[model samples]
Target: MHRLAIALLLIGGAGTAQAAGIRCDGGLVDRGDLQIEVLDACGEPDFRDDWAAGSLPAGVVAPDVTQWTYNFGRGNLLYILRFRNGRVIGIDNDGYGFDADNTSEDCGPTDIVPGMTKYRLLSACGSPAQRDSRVVLRSSRHFRYGVAEQIRRETWIYNFGSRRLLRKVILENGRVVRIDTDNRGFD
Candidate 1:
């Protein structure tokens, strides 16, 4: 480990702390002590772009941003990758036009029904907003202003003999009119 690595590890809080397995040399980013790496078509190069390129810019309204920003045009997409012990733990993808008002509401524990199959849940939600190896839960709320948003919720579910959804749920939101899975699945 070099001084930059050590310094980053020290500055990064213990809360985001991840195992040493994640490369801390130069490819990794230490935030709140959590080791995060963003991967895309270009491969994992040193994270160099200014944070502002995305939603959170330094000294800006956003104080907490975990990933570096990548923009090619209207197709600009922001992503966050979590690593545990140097291996990827989780990945988050966000594109432009993302807004808080249009964000997905938290399902909490009340949203899930045990022994629920992907097929069953898909029917209940009218159609799957999105699906992967994880479970899919989406909700539509119409505000008084006539504006509406579709909140896309994710829970990793497996389709095999076990055929079960994982415990935790990853929740996200998108425009109400544009509710369709972009085919982002672990498979």
Candidate 2:
């Protein structure tokens, strides 16, 4: 029993290490790869988001951050690649991918929830009928001196026809923060 437990622990650690890299077009793209290299290996991603962090000093420029989401297929898991400056910094698995051809109209407004990625929302609910975005400065006590960061906020309004109410999904940075139901939707 002791030997079996040791083996299982080793296997779990190995699985975590393996998740640091992803395969693309017979090539492996790992952390520290350049953005161009990932693009060449993986081709274009299904969804892309670009934003910049706020700097503390007046003359300092914050690095630009980009997130690329790839959905291989229904049988595979969705991957989100985060790039800082021009190099890959991290890779995260969002959720299970769905068939692109069959997902557009398959979900309702209640399917959306906080913390879900925009890529997942798009896959489940399709494009929003209306979209609006703006950048706001938010101050946080976590940082020394309560520094303010410029954050991007977006509102996506989905119309599910007259049968369902309109859903307004609010996103901060790139993740969904809140979901609200408006009045009845149009036909």
Candidate 3:
């Protein structure tokens, strides 16, 4: 493989935090701080926006990015943090943030449940807070090492803040198979 591909593989394989803290409060919130640290520093964002497919600028990687919106009472500039491959790559001041908070205490029901079709799930929850997909090759239970089985796994995250925690929906073969939750509530 080429150098870029190799680097992408290595970076993606590490499975690091997709989003992190915003620079605010006259203090510094640097890139690669992780989601928890971001939450601790920024408190809670007013609203969030996620994009799975879009026109990326030249030389930028596609997919696997989480964008956060923080509105500190409107007078302050809205912070938009973009995390790529598990770390914050850039931070910008978006025009304004929603008056309504995006926290679990504020966000409506996730509308995600087991056995729901991808379409229904998307329609209900919108494009996930963050998305990650991977392919693994392993031998089946038969122990035929030469005959490897391919497994495709996709994980979608919805951050509902501390009240509802974060929801992790796991899918296999384009179908929901399991659901998990954690306190890492920032999507």
Q: Choose the strongest candidate by TM-score.
A: 2
1-187 per-residue lDDT for model 2 (tens digits): 0000000111122111214667776377777999889887778888898875543456645567798877777656667788887898877766556667777566787789898888878778878899987766677876577566767788999998899889999998777899999999989
- List where candidate 3 sits over 4 angstroms from the true fold: 1-110, 184-187
Q: Give per-residue lDDT, candidate 2, residue 147.
A: 66
Task: Give the poorly placed runs of model 1, Cα more than 4 Å off.
Answer: 1-15, 18-153, 160-168, 171-187
- Candidate 3 residue-wise lDDT at 101: 31
Taking all chains together, each candidate's TM-score versus the true structure is: 0.21, 0.75, 0.38
TM-score of 1: 0.21
lDDT of 3 by residue, 61-152 (tens): 44555666555543444455666665667655433333333323333444666655343355346677888876544467775544444445
Candidate numbers, best TM-score first, in rank order: 2, 3, 1
> Which number leads on lDDT?
2
Model 3 TM-score on a 0 to 1 scale: 0.38
lDDT of 2: 0.73
Q: In model 1, where is the ten-residue run with the lowest total lDDT?
A: 1-10
Model 2 segments more than 4 A misplaced: 1-19, 52-61, 144-150
